[model samples]
Target chain A: MIIDQNKIDETIKIIKANGGHGIQKCVQCGACSAICPGVKAGFPLLCRALIKDLLNGLLEENIENSSSWGCQACNRCTEVCPQGVRPQEVVFAFRRYQANELAFSTSAVTSQMNLYETGHAVFTDPKEARRKVGLPEETPTSAFNEAAQQEIRTLMDNSPMGELGLF
Target chain B: MEQIGLYLGCNIPLKNPDIEQSFRKIFPALDVQPVDLEGAGCCPAWGTAPSFDLNTWCAISSRNITIAEEKNVDIMTGCNSCFGVLSEAKHFLETPATRTAVNNSLAKINREYKGTSDIYHVAHVLHKKIGLTKIRENLKYKLDGLKIAVQTGCHTLWPSDVYKVKEDNPYFPTMLKELCEVTGATVCHYSRLEGCCGMGGMRSTDAEKSLKLFKEKLLSIKEETNADMIVTTCSSCFMQFDMSQPILKGRGVIDFEPIPTFYYTQLLALAMGFDPQQVACISQIDRNPIIAEIQSDTRRIKEGM
Candidate 1:
């Protein structure tokens, strides 16, 4: 709860650097949280609360909070915000910081690995399902195309995420 | 051959290909070819690439969209996450800086996103692109006497600024309801019609909590509207509704028998007289009763003819 000026400035700077350009536009209105499904689902640090903490210099202090992972990326927070803060962007920005810190929620690591392996984070074997549905056993997607997936892997491998070695 | 690139994200083609199969049948029946964008990957789903870096998210999604851009057609998907994430990537990539960075990653793959291809969800394509009148005219069966509840889901509704297809009013959306009604089904209004289904990020993070959130929404659809079935436009919402009920019931979370669910295309394909097993019969929850009801309507129409 201690408001360190240096920490607060660093917090604002990090989030803005991570694509939360509208961080300072927030007027502290609770409209974003009022409509945030993540908060209602009991993951406390999202939208208003997460923004409040980030604005108050609690970024590193709340690194391990899994609430950011609960964001549906529905952009409902962006829709209802009066200040045009786009609170969802702020949440994602903090999530970028968290991911960089290697504080990934257990589920995130699995999905990231899936992306690296199959080019789809939420992949499943579609052979049986596609067959059952009377379609070709393999979908015409990157999941089955090794060359395309290799291209995807190269793209991810060259990105900032590759630098983290999470893949 | 009027066509659009069919962007099948992770779930539809892999987990629930029935929705993919239905889309294939429905769009072509309406005279719009669902062209396959081969080699397209995930929307890079929110939790994966998007969580790591903004440009990484845009780049991975851009790779998928660039496939459509190369085909010189916009993209359409049933997955709301695909719709939302792809649109967000397009919007972000419009900026000079973000576009430069994302295109850098894409350049390594020999693809450059010129931001030409717009992202379209199946809901938008059906209502706005195909037109309700066109849909109604082509239907071979009408779903009379079937009371339905529609879940529009989150991604297709929100942050409207990024989407090219604008709803008349995103908050109280009427497009999905109208699309359903054209097939002669009454889309009953429920209290939580616009509420989140608690899928996507929440589902991956905490399965049980996500189920509870979905249960709350399902209970609203049941207690308030007493709908005969649930229909949604988003693949993720369709999956959550299709997969969650048995879990909710098995855990004794709800005492009512679960309602069968469909992605809009699956139901639309049935209304157009496609075979049930091919288009609508692959849900975790049993949909035989609803499919039978729809098939009987088909028989009556055929007999009257």
Candidate 2:
């Protein structure tokens, strides 16, 4: 990506306006990315790299490729960063940007969409959550005529039962 | 004739029944009447609201508050996440413009919150309203020799500048310690006293982060304090420390004695001479030693022959 001084300046200006501090305090150390639980889970993202890209005007609105949903929002880096930069908050801000500005969605939205289609998030209400945990059949929904979607709902609800069943 | 609205959230009715049971057992002695609010759902912690989505959070939180206001009592929560959400709404409504915005948003839900109710964590009810001094008078048992490490959970302490008190010092592990002291237990000091538990951030969706945080905290508890057990007032924190800690140990991230996690009420009840069974024994995450220890102590005391 070609570096654009104007774009970098604009991004910095906007982020700072939104209460993001420590932009200039980054010393190129990768501690924020290293300590991030997201990167540990196969997300090719690093805070230092993002900062460098932002400084070089190569920042993209879509961060879906960067393990954005992988963030646990733990703020460990914010606590441990020597430069006092809050990369955790930055990642959150990026998520906001993606959701609000870039219009990117997360995998979590699939379950939410499934819920919107059905009265309950899962196909089977199971009446009691405990029954749902025990792998009961999902309550059939007239919303989506697909039996597979209903089964998916049942399976999702039953997934937590692994703990109940000692799996 | 003190009254408080009960916001049970979802866990008590479905998954964890003992919390509500314990609350009912203990509240009457302290003059607290917990009224039930029907039609309440999850607070949606991070689901319905972003950090800046204060308006949505207020509407959801206010629905419960409105229910409490109808009963004309302060709102008391059995779940820590519910307490945090309701408290945040209450805190936001304390401001005029924010109150107006929240009330305006609730028009969709056909509810208007007047900001009349006070939301409190169960710990606040027991430690603040009931006052430990008075609770101490009811003790049927004494945990005089037990060493406890109080795990003050994240949401309870975060935004510490606003939510936390100097006396409690979430950053220093004092409030929980003080509560334990009322029951006559020695508090073990440990590092990371003010840190967030990894469980708070949708750890249900992502387990590794929760596991990492739990592992680190378990190691800290073992290395820093010679505590016989770890206790917390938050249900999620209890679940993480008690349940996730063992999973992490199984993963071999840390090797230490799996300290049992107890709810603040359970600890208080145990010290007050309620049998561990009455405190709801088997549901605990790391259940082995604490129950055994209490059982052996009770047996020893009974067999005076």
Candidate 3:
């Protein structure tokens, strides 16, 4: 594979912009992978591997891999990294690239759609539960307030999520 | 006695209104006022906006914080995922570049990312703001003989840097255990105490894989602690254990009987003399056996005293 230095630089730039500070300082220490439940659960992608690929300008070749989504984003990787590489942030950075520049998972799209439509990512008719618990039949949430839902919709419409046709 | 704005996020209101009700009863009893975070939307969750872009994630999360800012109070959430997203959003907005981009998006809605309010998990508020002394004093009934396992959830412990209140040792956090102990329950030390319950976006992405993680944690809790009840600080973890365990068992993934689960606030509400029907109304798994055990133990303790 052709090693595109410009692609690697662009990827790093986006990662840095998205709170993946100290990512380049990653020392290929497998601590993140060792601690990651995703790796434990048999996912192929590991934080150390992803960082190596990103640094080597190989992210695009592996951009479509589902293993990127395996991250729980538990921040365990961030906690154990000696170099402060914050591998979870790098995972998120790659996810952002996949989601915006390429494609997003159906579940992600549905969740964004839920947020746009109802002002919540997971909306259920909560009135009965609230009333059962002696709370007002209508809890103070966007689900009960049309004006609030509109405000959320407007925000999503103007955000990058909307631009990506996520909603 | 400061009023703290309550951010319900999505799950607590929908899947576990009982936890919300528990907070309602317990917060006032502790002298900490719980204000309704009116018109606040989703934390937009990590699986959604943060997966797409940071600027969008921060903008949406900042909007929610701005609502709390307008109320002039710090925001507290019962869900760890909401805590994680909102706290990270606050941290993101602290940087000029990210804040400017987020503000640029917010400008469309006539809003700005003002770093005025801090986000807190409810457990932090109980430990820091409410104080263990107050909690102990208000306990009308002690969980004297109850052996409880605690799940602090992944979000509450990790990324401790952005969080305003953190466990003294984030790796082996004591805040949840300490809070559980104040209810007079013996907090058990489990091998997998810090493992993820796998109830986040991962569950939706791959249910089988998610259940594998939950099964491992649950089995470890059962084997290591063998506690009567499991208490958690996060609503998602509550669902994973209380809601998912039976299904996993039925699917033949595990053979152990499902353990009863409680959000720490619900346990507090019950220990503070509220009826179980009042605070813990909606549990997927049967809690009657555990509740009966607690009541019987309380009576025995009362007789001894």
lDDT of 2 by residue, B189-252 (tens): 7776655466654465466655666666677788888688888878777777777766766777
Off by over 4 Å in 1: B297-299, B302-305
Clashes found in each candidate (C-alpha, N, C closer than 3 A): 0, 5, 0
lDDT of each: 0.87, 0.59, 0.84
lDDT of 1 at A30: 94
Find the candidate with the highest DockQ and give its number: 1
Q: Give model 2's docking category.
A: incorrect
lDDT tens digits by residue: candidate 3, A32-95: 9998877777667659888888888776677777776878888998888899998998888887
Candidate 2 or 1, higher DockQ: 1
Report the number of the highest-lDDT candidate.
1
lDDT of 2 at A22: 67
Docking class of 1: high
lDDT measured at residue B239 in model 2 versus the true structure, 0 to 100: 70
* lDDT: worst 10-residue window of model 1 chain B: B296-305
Give a tens-digit lDDT track for model 2, residues A34-61: 7665555445554666666656655464
Could you tell me which residue pairs clash in candidate 2? A123-A139, A124-A138, A124-A139, B140-B272, B141-B273
- What TM-score does prediction 1 earn? 0.97
